[model samples]
Target: MALPLVPRAIAAQPWPALLSAAFLAAFGFVTLYSAAGGSLLPWAFPHAARFGVFLGLALAISYVRPSWFREIVPYAYVGVMVLLVVVLAVGVVGGGARSWLDFGPIRLQPSELMKPILVIALAAFYSAMPPRHIQTFGAIWPAGLMIGIPVVVILLQPDLGTSLLLTFSGITTMFLAGLPLKWFIGGGVAVGGAVPAIFPFLMPHQQERILILLDPSQDPLGAGYHITQSTIAIGSGGITGQGYLNGTQSHLNFLPEQHTDFIFSAMAEEWGLLGGIAVLVGLGVLLRWGTRVAMDAKDRYEMLAAGGLTSIIFFYAAINLMMVMGLAPVVGIPLPLLSYGGSAMMTVMICLGLLMGIDRRTRRDRERRRGL
Candidate 1:
């Protein structure tokens, strides 16, 4: 029953998942179109180009063997960590945050790279350790170091969003690796206790964001402007939306970062409740499919990596949506695939590539089992 030629490869690819992602990117491009007032130069065109480039990149990476991925995880983590140090030494300041590195042609955010790299490192670390050592401090500290190094670096970069993502991805991987619940609870308690100590070190805007999250009305026109504007935009969009290219808040300059983090509000304004639901449904499909990939993985490394990758994706979608809806602090996390930023686009596509690789591997395994 084995088939020949290009269709064989096509048959193995996850068409459903890829199609789901494509629908989201397309819908997002439409939103970006409105954000740019019907122009494509500023955001939509470049967004499309980057999506094509990164999607192709992900598809190419899908061909890499699982064993090869295992070999590269540690190296990738080390490389990203080094880039973070370089960022610290010579990073550029944007939006009052020193998180990007200027390399003449392209400004890069190395901390974004750590989202996937950190997960891979932690997954590899736990995969190598014996299960008997799971509850031991010996098991805990090394992984903590793996997580802490980049976190501290990114925090100094004062990029709370990326650091939180890295920590979440790493911790989730450890949980999947069989770490006990009590350890997680104790860690949570310790974090709560240490918040007072960490508060002083927070940047002014960071503190303002937390305060804004607590009560946006405190400075509705100043520090709380973003959330206030964002909520207004979202609420104004009734059921079917204001229609394409007709959102007043974004087009009139009332919504900040409309083409980036707050694109969702603009989108909701134009497309309405159904449109918002559509975007969430598409992402939910991707998430559910990704989780299934982890469940179907053949080994511990595959399982941990797949689940960790899914967590990274989930964290971005959940956080960005929450931030826009006034449920969480605006730490500058962008909506995956939808937000207009190369760093987030690159990170999300990499995760998709890893998922593609896992899904492809699963198919190959099944085919082999049937003696195809």
Candidate 2:
């Protein structure tokens, strides 16, 4: 007879998720090692400490139950929204944007957390509704209202990249929850057309970015310097990198933000095409598993949450990769696992935990259905 599956085995171990997490942590340490570019000992200690903290957070999240995740969606959404408002009121300015809220010893970026919170809230809202009811106009307005609040607040922070991400993630969840394709495509076209007209309302720097994206050579040493350096670093890496820690672009300070947002270019410069592809493959694995979870989900909540989380991660990864590859503008979005930031690390870990919870619950519900 075939052996029965152990709960330990059947319960989601989240290995793909874990692998993605490790690749990020390892890449992070290496990037930080390159970031310091000189002090090996100090870089080693702090990098290890951050990796340990993220490790603990990831493992802790892996153990959380799905029901608990469901129960706390409303509370978490409210709390995160409050924090976003607080960030606007008294947040630290970084890269010409105030996206961080100070809380004594630690600073939090509610916008970072908002992506996942919006996902969960939308999932919960949709799950509570009757199947066909959400398809009607009545349900769509409240959902739009729910997402609009944060989108406006985040945009008021003048953070276009994150605001766009939040809007995309929320709408994606709604779409996955059986939102009509006609509405989705129509809304997309309208937004696409409206963006240019709205461009003038953006801050000068934001306007310059769009302009620069259209023609990167316009101000090569000014607003365009970052992408210019990033492209050079990536191109110089060629098929094989210059070798880790030996990237002249980063080590000599030609590439700005080498340790944080632009680390992909740094890695590409050092490890070349193969290394970059490895990171992409790891991310692909995580996405595939997330899609599986969504497909196997027992209810709309699990499906929507899993699908939304997947899209959030996918979009972030795509944007980061595209920016590094010179295929898109430098929108100042961080690579999900590879970028260095306490807020992003925590937010991503929490998201992984939510995914684990949904996957585990879905597996259990399936086994029970089979009377296993």
Candidate with the greatest lDDT versus the true structure: 1
Per-residue accuracy of model 2 over 1-372 as CA lDDT, tens digit each: 776576656445777777777876777677678767755444445655766786787667766776567798788888988988887888899878889877787877889888888888888888889978967987688889889999999888878888877888899899988877888899889989999899889888888877888777889999888889999998899888998778999888999987667889988998899988888888888889888888988777788889998888888888878887667777778887777767766766777777887877777777898997
TM-score of 1: 0.97
In order, the Cα lDDT scores of the candidates are: 0.89, 0.81
lDDT, candidate 1, 1-372, per-residue tens = 666667866767888778888888888898898898899978999889989999999998888876687888778888888888988888899766789989887888988888887787777788888889888988899999999988998899888888888888899899999988999999999999999999888999899999899999999999999999999999999999888899999999999999888999999999999999999999999999999999999888889999999999999999999999999999999999998989898999999999889888887899899998
Clashes of 2: 0
TM-score of each: 0.97, 0.92
Candidate 1's error at 145, in angstroms? 0.5
> Model 1: residues >4 Å from true position, as ranges?
1-6
C-alpha RMSD values across all candidates: 1.6, 2.7
lDDT, model 1, position 80: 83
Could you tell me the TM-score of candidate 2? 0.92
- Name the top TM-score candidate: 1
